[model samples]
Target: MAVAAAVIRCRRLNIPRAFVISMMINAIQAAIGRSMDPLLTPPAGNSLHIKASSVDGVQIYTCSGGEWRFLSASASLVDSSNSSIFIGTYAYVYSPKHVSAIGTWSLNNSEGVIAESGHAASEVTGRVIAFRGNKFALPAFLAQASSHLFDGTASLVSYIQQIPSDGGVPPGSSSCRKGSRQVHIPFEADYWFWTQDRQPPSVPSELSAIGLMIEGFFGTGHVKYVFNGTSWQQKNITASMYDVPGGILVGRFFIESHADDAGGSFTWEVFNPNGWTVTAKSASPGVQVDGSSLPWRLFSVTSASFNESFLGPITQVQMISTRGGLPPTPMQAQAVVETWKIMLLQWSFKVCMKISDSECTIT
Candidate 1:
């Protein structure tokens, strides 16, 4: 196998034995994680889960060769009130409508607005432009902030995710020709922005980089977080909790225990009839769960069936915040265990390979 060859090469290169083993473990985890969600796997490590904005835009397509090809996207990033906060675009284009827009602004504006002054544009990744149809699924994206607006919403943003939504597929090839030129199809999606280190007030400050913020106490508690530009605060819930992996999939089922270096697992099947089941594929060492000595682990969704799913088409999931979920130490003992935890599930994009600042589109 290719993995076996890679390991042999690593050994031949005089690499540390421990480093080689860690690399192999990560490779295996990533491979299994892909089985959970093929297209939208969030990058591992620490990152602050920030804001989610609604995007109403058009997917542009141009007829070329013998088929219709995707050109770019033109959209508006709106806030909770549905008011346009910034413009979203793929390539560079100067809009005549707004002076200091988010996507593409004049490199040299008469109002003294320029990229050097921090009024730059944004670049997007994770769009499935080649496929066209109702069933065509677009992957979730991660957009890096280049030049930011003065208001500071997009300033601290390290990445942006375009959550899957309906009505974005391009027109059929039968409708376009070489002479058909370009067509704009209207579409809507939610874009989640992320920073380096920031947490919601309800979530503990120590547990950072939460893609999902979950808070509950044993079987009877509440789940609080945000999605699709909507706030979900203190939603009541019920479920069973287990210290080990397997079973009916209600509450926390530990797959990979934090205490173990080889890692363990856990699953959350809180929503019955149509809920998501997230499982831990690996363990991230160092950081401890909120108030506990146990390190928080990241999970991938193995199955999902929610009636009103905020995690549309499924993306990335991780237990960003936690409180009192670890097994008791030798001295501590209790008949009943109640724990508070937060799990974040959002989609992510792979870093564009071989990219330059002048051309940042994912190739």
Candidate 2:
């Protein structure tokens, strides 16, 4: 009985030992299996939680933010986030739906400077350049055509027009003639005439010539000529008469005296070069010019005038007219005047001059 008891004790001991041995063998096999097939086991806990789609080759575990380690000893760690991870290059994570790959990867190494499929040949070859602030640098060859050669404020149209090409004389100088035989002559020292028929004949009766003569008479004024096909039209005549302050002159003169009496009254519209509009009209029939009636005589001098506080600072002026009646006879009418005249008063204020056929001094 004693021997049997001892044998039973030994048997029990052997059973435990054998069980322990079996457990040891199974643990070794499990470890080997995990090493051989990395995908079968779940990644270790307390490790990085990498998205399955963000990596390939092996699973990566991160103990903390920005800290990563591989689960399989054989697999290596690769950064796969879309961030600059290498020198002068960036990383991008990618995973195909069909594959069971996981972990971080170095996108720069496999993908190169540009992606294989999405980028053009030039971009893949590193020809493309990028700049800060989301800017882009064009290739040198492309820059030759795309770059601006002129300053931002340069105007091609204005530059071309100003390139010494003839713009023709101002609209008003179209009718102006140079010599005494012509109806109009520009006011210049060379144009001053001693007689009506001579080379330097008397000033033409046209407004342009009259303006020049008036400038000579005032000793300090300028004359501009505009041609209306038949005669030179004078505009913006500024005459500084003797012994007058604030004496700036502004007026227009019509070459055709008969225009006013044609029942087609002339309307003179004045405008400063700055585009301010002002108007002056010829005295109408039954209207008073220096206290007289219109149609008194065709070519009769009549001055209808106006005044404004803002006429000062005026550097240039323009005039236009429209007529609407049959021409009048000389005896039946007086010399017609179709302009506004402003003269400085003794007090240095502007005073309008309203002259009639008899009031004006023709000589």
Candidate 3:
């Protein structure tokens, strides 16, 4: 009955005529379609839930009582998050750690850098953090056209993790690390939870405004581009590529990629200003004449996986091709929404209300 009333509202003479809407409406039937208004405008308090769907797939956003957040796990967010928190899906090429470090460091592996694995591969996590509270979109990837040349003698391994430098969670118990169990993440600078909308009298214009701009390296055996809020950018010396010291840090991933001979030289270094012991290891035996822009190139093994949630599997994501609608003309998006509303009315009348042949009663 309420649907019937909604149809009438859409039909008011003051409103525009119904038009054929996109297939996105059907895609988001489980959640509010992107065309719909948010349930909460200023969102009474905080932690307001916002979900939208389109033909591409579903996206999620939330006001975390203090700010809006796009639920995603980046190399940084994972450092403090619980093991259960959903990180976005990942996809990338894979390769074994070629050689051991030939620099000044050891292998104690503390903080978010404790690694038990010997193999290394490039990686790419989901750029968007759209997901239901604990659920998320499974990021997909295009396989590398041609993978790197592997020696076949190298061994594959799982992700690396930190052992907790602050003495661990159980306090004094060495095995109790106080952060997420993910090991692949290198440092906090490359990726992080972007909480820009903490205090909001003015709500964000779009969902991307309140999500994670998780960063990763590109080219050097890593994913091609890193998400930089606006779009995925190719990794270089940019923040998305090289994180500042003292966070979840990975040395080899950065160094290996930027190296000049591009292959022959291997060096690893760990710099933690907060008192975490610095350690390095020469996986094989390196130390060649190197000239990477930054002595150390971000080295990452490639890997792939999808973001899955208890709600449903996210199959696709609409990427910001030329970047987002930077200069959002007021009501530009709203116009499409209005069109959708009219289409919805038409659908409800014909399918549910059983009204037909130009007979869509006002009530």
Q: Which candidate has the top score in lDDT?
A: 1
Model 2 earns a TM-score of 0.13
Report the lDDT of model 2 for residue 358.
19
Local accuracy of candidate 2 as per-residue lDDT tens digits, 1-363: 001121211111244554675576457447544222222111111111221111112222223222222222111222224323321211112234412221111112234424533322110011111111111111010000001112111100010000011111121333323431212111100000000000111111121111111110011233333434334344433323211111122332323334343332332223244222222333222211111111111122232234232212211111111111112233322322222122111100111222112112222
Question: Local error of candidate 2 at 303, Å?
Answer: 18
Score candidate 2 by lDDT: 0.20
Model 1 lDDT per residue over 74-174, tens place: 66555534455444333323344532232421111223334344544423222221112242554354333434434223343444445656666776768
Q: Kindly report which residue stretches of model 3 are placed more than 4 angstroms away from their true locations once superposed.
A: 1-30, 35-237, 240-363
**Where does model 1 exceed 4 Å of error?**
1-56, 81-138, 144-151, 198-363
Ranking by lDDT: 1, 2, 3
Candidate 1, overall lDDT?
0.36
| Runs with alpha carbons beyond 4 Å of true place in candidate 2 | 1-246, 255-271, 275-363
Ranking by TM-score: 1, 3, 2
Q: What is model 2's C-alpha RMSD?
A: 48.2
